[model samples]
Target: MRCDQVRQTLEESGEAYPAPVLHHLRHCPECAAYEHHWRWVRAGLLALARETAPEPSLGFARRLIRRLEEGFLPMRLVGEFFETAGRRVVYFTLLLATVLLLAIALPSSGPLRGRPARDVSWPQPEIVATRDYPIPPSELPGAGFSLTSESDVSGGQK
Candidate 1:
């Protein structure tokens, strides 16, 4: 390990003998020296006291309220309101509108919702079977023949 890494480990762990890294350091003279020096230097780094922080001002609350009243919230914090409000309204409105539009536009094909249609059955036309009048070759027009009125057949002869 480098000198700085050993120093950091010594400072963070605050131990004379590091079981994990000491094995690697003992084999390496540079690292072992770094660990030895860091252990001594760690004394200075560990000298910090809980009393070092300055006392809070008596008027801290009053000052904080004044700052709040002045609309001095951080830019990122100020943006949170607009961001959350826009997301709620836009997403909610879009979903609501989509649901309403779909309800109005879609076909309700269920038996209860759909209207009943008139019964209709389109059947294939059949060849007229009659023993009295035999179908002649001349009477055949096409694949599906349309029969003329009986009066028309007789009127043409008259």
Candidate 2:
């Protein structure tokens, strides 16, 4: 077996060396050194496990829980609001007020206000009634010639 496989077996088995691992450890000096180092580390960890851990001062947990339950005061909550979102809201309001003030203060002739109106007058179209033109003699039906007015064509009383 490889040195890595032997070391892995030693780490996995923990104090119980398999037959193949024992054979490898006897042959590989580096693996034997690694196994020795791990043994010392395991002994130290075991010693630490046997000793009692340090305890917190009495009422520490109760005080912490009470503080969490009590929550923040209204003024402190307001202060926190100002520290975060309130400041941004104030800045945005100030910016909007400044833009509105500039729009009101500046003259209409300003570049951002757009182009001024020009004095342009288009020619008026001439309106000609159909009755204004005399009918051609050749276009009239045989033996009868009539000129109709706007009222006659529109079914109005003649």
Candidate 3:
């Protein structure tokens, strides 16, 4: 087997070498040296783990508890507020009222706030002008234009 593969297997299994790797290590000096080095490294790590374990600084637990409590306080307050049916109903009512007010006020405020001012005066010819254009008789056929009553359109009912 390759030295890297044997090394990975040794590192992972930590004392469980397969028969092929054991035979290969016996025949290969480079792989045997690597196995010896890895064994020494593992022994050192075990000794380190057996020695003094790490301890947190003073008040570390208390500070962590305080931070967690502070972070959750607002969420807890909101949860309590929603837990009561009255508060939940009141909150939804206010929200709905606000949405309704905005819906009504925004559209109606358009004429007051968004529209341009009356630039044309009351007697302005442009505003008062008729949209109609009377067609001249010359434009009509020899079945000339006439009206007997408002209903008699053919222009002349021929």
Candidate 4:
């Protein structure tokens, strides 16, 4: 058998070589060296897997559990609600509904409110005219029309 066939057999069987592959290994020095190297690698990996992993100290799990249980309940609820897609969508929908209700319920108080806002008269009326008096001199400069009261200007002295 070829070296490749022997190598394939060695990898497939893990530490056990078939009798025919072993006969091939006895004749081929290169295949024998390769098999020995792969066997050492497998043994090292097996030993590493069997080694003990590190563990936390005695009360770590208890302390962590107690801390979680005693922490803020509202914050924990919010955290859990945001942890998944469906929960987050529900939370967002609830939040949107709350905002929408508040918007509808609260009375709006600004110039943009429901009732049409009355336009504020600019430059107050008194500045333009008095009850029945002539317009201000500063306002009407040269319209030559003069208002004469029947008591004063019917027949002028000057």
Report the CA-based lDDT of candidate 4 relative to the real structure: 0.76
Clashes of each: 0, 0, 0, 0
TM-score of each: 0.33, 0.42, 0.37, 0.35
lDDT of 3 by residue, 30-119 (tens): 888988998999999999889986799999889879978887566677787768977879999999999888777785435545654564
Tens digits of lDDT, candidate 1, 1-158: 66566657766775765775776676778777877786676566667542387878999999989988997887887699889998999999999999999889877655545653532344424534342453443465475554765566666556
Best-first order by lDDT: 2, 4, 3, 1
Prediction RMSDs, each to the true structure: 15.8, 16.8, 15.6, 21.3
The global C-alpha lDDT for each of the candidates, from Candidate 1 onward, is: 0.69, 0.78, 0.73, 0.76
Worst 10 residues of 3 by lDDT: 127-136
- TM-score of candidate 4 relative to the true fold: 0.35
User: Which candidate wins on lDDT?
Assistant: 2
Instruction: Please list the residue runs of candidate 1 whose C-alpha ends up more than 4 Å from where it truly belongs after superposition.
Output: 1-12, 16-27, 49-51, 72-158
Clashing pairs in 1: none
Error of 1 at 89 (Å): 28
Q: Tell me the tens digit of each residue's lDDT in model 2 across 1-158.
A: 98888888898898889999999888889999999999999899989999998899899899878877897356777789878897899899999999999989998864787655542444433432244555444455565555765556555432
Q: Which ten residues in a row are the worst by lDDT in model 1?
A: 118-127
